[model samples]
Target: MSMFDKTTKMAAVLKGHPKAKEVLESFGLQCSTCSGAKHESIELGATNHGLDVNELLTHLNALFDEPPGK
Candidate 1:
């Protein structure tokens, strides 16, 4: 299983994958402490931020897909 899916919540993703924080930040979503992360889906957040959700999802999933130690 991947670390994140489109429906995955920001909090859950960050909790499960620490490296995800960097990716989220790169996507302009520095919401580590935001309440919305607790319930907002990745897609929703991306949409709200006027970002490309698919690109974000791909980047997020790809980050986890990489072999350990890149």
Candidate 2:
């Protein structure tokens, strides 16, 4: 039961998780300011950025375990 996967849209991820921007930035993805974030899926972004999609998803899903303001 992961909170996000390859098909998850960047916009949806940002909206769904409070720390998504931070997490994304850590992986070198400046999604918050990118227009493509509106329609780009995690998989696409990762591929375009030369990142490992599975690694990104792992970090993104880890956010689900944190307390709401952490």
- Whole-model Cα lDDT of every candidate shown, in order: 0.86, 0.93
lDDT of 1: 0.86
Tens digits of per-residue lDDT, candidate 2, 1-31, equal 4789899999999998889899999998999
TM-scores of all candidate predictions against the true structure? 0.87, 0.93
Clash totals in order: 0, 0
Error of 1 at 23 (Å): 0.3
The RMSD (Cα, Å) of candidate 2 is 1.0
The 10-residue segment of model 2 with minimum total lDDT is 61-70
Candidate 1 lDDT tens digits, 1-70: 4667889989988987668899999988987978899989998999999999989988888877777887
